[model samples]
Target: MKHYLRPEGSPPVNGYSHAVAFSGTSVAVSGQVPVDAEGRIVGEGDPEGQLRQVFVNLRTALAAAGAGMADIAKLTVFLTDLADLGAFRKVRDEFIDVERPPACSLVQVVGLVHPAFRVEIEALAVLPVESVQPG
Candidate 1:
């Protein structure tokens, strides 16, 4: 169960809500990079490919915590280059709901720990009691 909020005075968000509210157990997914379960990087010099791997990692993290993409209330996206914003949205919508998207914060940074990583994402999710067990 979740509710999206767009305060009257707030600027409209294109791909996400201004705020979200939900009542349930919460889980924090640490910033996920392009690396996979075996610690091998998937994409290099490819923002879209890196983004896909990032979302996959995010999904895995949520699953481990007894939650899924639909349960996410908020997301923080980091990219070294803002030019890929359009590309990011295209791939992100594949995983998250377009109508009931989570609140989001996207930002550009100088660089990530690894030069190959162009995108990283972290999420805060709320899980319903019957949906899953504890991690």
Candidate 2:
């Protein structure tokens, strides 16, 4: 994957790239919330804890598709409050490569599917052709 961190005319980025280029089997991961496998909310009103669970869910979902966090090319994040941006970035860095971050878009929404959910993240990844297995 190629990360266009600072394109010629693009503005400086904080923790994401302007764009990403990759050739492989495309994998689309649905939006993930801060719920565990049992559907129980992991964090109540804490942004850090909520973001952590979201990342964990993303990892599990990616693995099921034969991909990992490093395979991700882009991310779409939704937060009920923009104030959680700091916690979001802190937790996100734990899962994604900081040096070659994926293209990302963050949106502040009024609320998520569940009122208890503070954040939701969706990812787009590319798995190398050789990594794809016959099913």
Candidate 3:
């Protein structure tokens, strides 16, 4: 995948690229947030609940991108509280298998979208070429 700024006239990218392109049979998705169906916050102040919601959102985003958990190669998480490690692992292991789990990263961030939010996650995936359509 090639990550690039949208374009000069396009909105500026702070640290992340405005767009990413995939030429291989796989796609890697960034960690998704815990926004709900109405695009509102869920699991306020609850790391475990919030992490679960992050997974759900990631699945939805991957589906829209023509991928799934089995296609994932890596999963990275960002959290506001390092003390939530236990909770994080509990939630992380739920969806991922031990045999060949994707590479993972967990970082402690100063803050997130809202002060109440405790976690956010992103992923790297490898979808079958036949399943991918160029964006």
Leading candidate by lDDT: 2
lDDT of 3 by residue, 19-87 (tens): 444555656676688788898888887878888889888888888888876566766789899998888
Alpha carbon lDDT of each predicted model: 0.89, 0.96, 0.73
* TM-score of decoy 2: 0.98
lDDT per residue as tens, model 1, 1-135 = 555657789887788988897877889999999998899998788888889999999999998887889999999999999998988999899999988999999999999989889998999999886765644
Best by TM-score: 2
Better of 2 and 3 by lDDT: 2
Better of 1 and 2 by lDDT: 2
Task: Rank the models by lDDT, top first.
Answer: 2, 1, 3
Candidate 1 deviant stretches above 4 angstroms: 130-135
Lowest-scoring 10 consecutive residues by lDDT in candidate 3? Answer: 12-21
Model 1: ten consecutive residues of lowest lDDT: 126-135
**Ranking 1 against 3 by TM-score, winner:** 1
Per-prediction TM-score to the true structure, in the order listed: 0.91, 0.98, 0.74
Q: Residue 27's C-alpha lDDT in candidate 2?
A: 94
**Which residue pairs show backbone clashes in model 3?**
26-127, 28-125, 30-122, 31-121, 31-122
Question: Residue 13 of model 3: what lDDT?
Answer: 33
Evaluate model 3: give its lDDT. Answer: 0.73
